[model samples]
Target: MTLLRRLIRLLCGTDPVLRRMLKYWAATCVLYVACIGMLLVQVELGLSNPAAANGLIAFGGCGAFAFYLLIRANARLKLEPDQLAVAQAVFSLVCAFWAYAISGPLRAAMLIMAVVIIVFCMFALRPRQTLVLSAVAIAGMGATMWWLQAHDPVRFPPATEALTFGYLAGALLSTALLSGEMSKLRSRLKRQKRELTEALETIRLLATVDELTSLVNRRHMNEVLKAEERRQAAGADTCIALLDIDFFKQVNDQHGHAVGDSVLRCFAAAARASLREGDVLARWGGEEFLLLLPDAAPGDARAVLERMAERVHAMLVPGLDGRRISFSAGLATRRAGEPFADAISRADKALYQAKESGRARIVLA
Candidate 1:
């Protein structure tokens, strides 16, 4: 079973585009098989010359094999899907015309083959392209039938040829019309699918992200903290820090909330740049942020918070003229089997102690 699975993967490959190309390619190859079958039956019934049937069969086999290799190798990366569909339609029509020209009694099968071609093409081509393909098939076959009636009137009678063409014309035109309507329906469904995906993404961002600083929101942070607490209980090192920007209310009260918002944005940007790749920061509340450091020792997590505090102290808030930004942080390394709420409460008390100890410093809990 594993060997069979490996062989299927080798032939079909893992590329989605290549698989789609091969699907249509395989359908066209099936039509080639039908053509060869018709030729063999015609020769057996003595309705076609054996010499002519042999040559046409060879041509059909070569065409199918060559096209299979082209589609399997380069067509997926190079050819537009509609262009490939049109090419396949043209090839199928050419082979059908060749087979019809040689067969005497079983020529009606060629009309069925043409109908199959148009119906298969509906999956890939537009209405206009299908219409064009239908017209070409009807005209080319009609011309071939008329020419054969003139040259071999004993085998292909004028009355029989005319009636067959009338049936062919109606079937192809009606199929073309229905294919166009279905193509339109398919386009509308694709558009609706794209719109639905975009709307879901917007809703997700609104639920989890803060609008002002574009950081993760408080509720989502709580979820992340609880997950980290569980990992800590399982022997993973996790740390939490409560960060509060110092003297932020005065910036809002004196310079207006617009400047305060700008300052918050600047602080978020600086704090983001200071953290390692695995660390997460979220807006805990107005003028307060939360930081999560997973898989870190107590001393290392404290050093990370101290570095973040230094970055806040050295940076300039955009609307503050030449004034610097400062923040106070309280760091707590999670103890085994402790709930995040208890850790947050201890960090909050440490934040108060930092405020009392002249601010702009980090206090370890």
Candidate 2:
């Protein structure tokens, strides 16, 4: 048993592709064996020449095995399955032609085997490939029929071979047409699937992003705060801030809503640049932004807001006429087990106080 297992492994490699090839070859070998048996039966019944039939069997059996072994030995080739099928079609056709020529009175039955090859190609080959293969089969069989009529008229009569060619042509051509139609359906479905995926991604972006400032919107920010609140429950320190642009309504009134929008966009860019890694910023509502600093100390959070204010002061939006911008912030640290909304409420009160005292400073809560 051990020796037999080793021999099987030696013949069929352990790769997934190799194992699959073994199964394919097993099915093909069964067909070859059946054909060999058919040839031997014809010879025993005196319907075919024993020597000629035996030679064709020997050639077919050896040729098919050689192709199988070649594919197995180069399992890493990763050959396209259609290309492999095409190779098998060519090999099978050559054997069928030989068997037809020598099978004598039973020559027409070989067309059935050719039909099987055409059906396999219908499933395996693309529309254009199927067309090319059909052309080759038609041409090869036509040439064979012409030769047999000229040299062996007694066995391959002109009228009979003519009828057989017509049957072969109609069968192959119709199957190829159906295969092409199936290919078009598959391609259209694949294209629609790709388009659906892209549409879903666009919808997700619109759901979570503020279209004006390009920051995370209030809804998504609330989700982030909930996540951070859970972290705070486990002894992690997080700070929350609510910052408002100073005199934003006046900017909109004086310079128009366009200039106000530019200022907001500019402030958002500066604030993002000033924040450290692991900081989350969002557009909470008009002119107001929320900031979350995870795993941070109160002092560190203060420094981050101060740095952001400095950057904001340096920014000049379009239509500002060289005037600079600044913002006021209310900062608060989350206590262990405190809810995120409570922390945000405290920050909002501090923000109102900062605006009353001065517009460009941060007030701690």
Candidate 3:
């Protein structure tokens, strides 16, 4: 299994369209080999003309190998979609010419193969290109019939020649129209899928992120806290710090709500810069935020919050002249298997102690 996966990775890489095309080409090669084998068996059993059967087998085997190599080369080159479509159309025409030459009694059946090729091209080529390729295919089939009739007039009578051409034309037209419609539907579905994916991503961001400060919202923070508590229950250390801006009400009263909002945004940005990668900062409420420090005890968590406090104190709000920002923080480490409510309550109590003791200090519980 590992070897197979490695081989596929080496061949197809990460492009889904390339992988699908590879699978299609692989299937086609397998079908070609099977048909060649059957033709050889018929020649051995004296059920087919030895000379004609040998020639057809040799031609088919070489053609299939050449086609496979061409596809592989194109895959390696990473050709654009338009170029690949043209290459495939040319290959299909060549195969149709071969089929027409050797068809004998099954001449009409070979036209079906040509129709299938044109229909397949609809997915990758525009309708106009598909129509053009269809015309080329019809021309190739007509030329093949003319050559065959010239060589052996008894087989392709002049009377049936008109009927054969008419059938090929009608088949190509109908298949092109139907396949063109299907191609349009496929394109519409692809566009809708892309739009839906983008919309889902936006909704997910709005649900979990605070719009104003770009921090995780309180609701999402609670979910994170619960998850951390579960990790704590498994003997991992985690701590939570509740932060409140000092005299934030005065900033709103004196400066205006817009200025207050700017202050909050600046503070949030500074706090994020000061914290470690594993720490999570979330907007708790108006002028309040929560920081979750995973794999940290109360002492380490307090040190982190103290650094953040110093950073926040140094931030300069534009409309506040030179007044500095300050925040009071309370840190509480979760005990093994302790409930989330109990830990938050302890942090709340410590926060109240810090507010009472001094406005710009951290209290650890």
* Model 2 CA lDDT for position 84: 84
lDDT tens per residue, model 2, 1-365: 59988898888867787788677767778888999998999999999999989889888878887877778856567787778878888888888888888888898899888777777677668999987887778788888898999998887889999999999888878877877998898889989999999999889888899999999999999888877776567535789999999999999999999999999899999999998998999999999999999988889999999899888998878898888888999999887778888889999999999999977889999
Worst 10 residues of 2 by lDDT: 228-237
Q: TM-score for every candidate vs. truth?
A: 0.88, 0.76, 0.88
Clashing pairs in 3: none
Per-residue lDDT of 175 in model 3: 78
Record all residue pairs in model 1 with backbone atoms less than 3 Å apart, i.e. clashing: none
The best candidate in terms of lDDT: 2
Please list the residue runs of candidate 3 whose C-alpha ends up more than 4 Å from where it truly belongs after superposition: 1-20, 37-49, 75-78, 234-236
Compared with the true structure, model 3 gives a TM-score of 0.88
RMSD of each: 2.9, 5.0, 3.1
Tens-place lDDT per residue, model 3, 305-346, is 989988998888899989999999888887777776777788
| TM-score winner, 2 or 3 | 3
Give the least accurate 10-residue stretch of model 3, judged by summed lDDT.
Answer: 39-48
- Count of clashing residue pairs in every prediction: 0, 0, 0
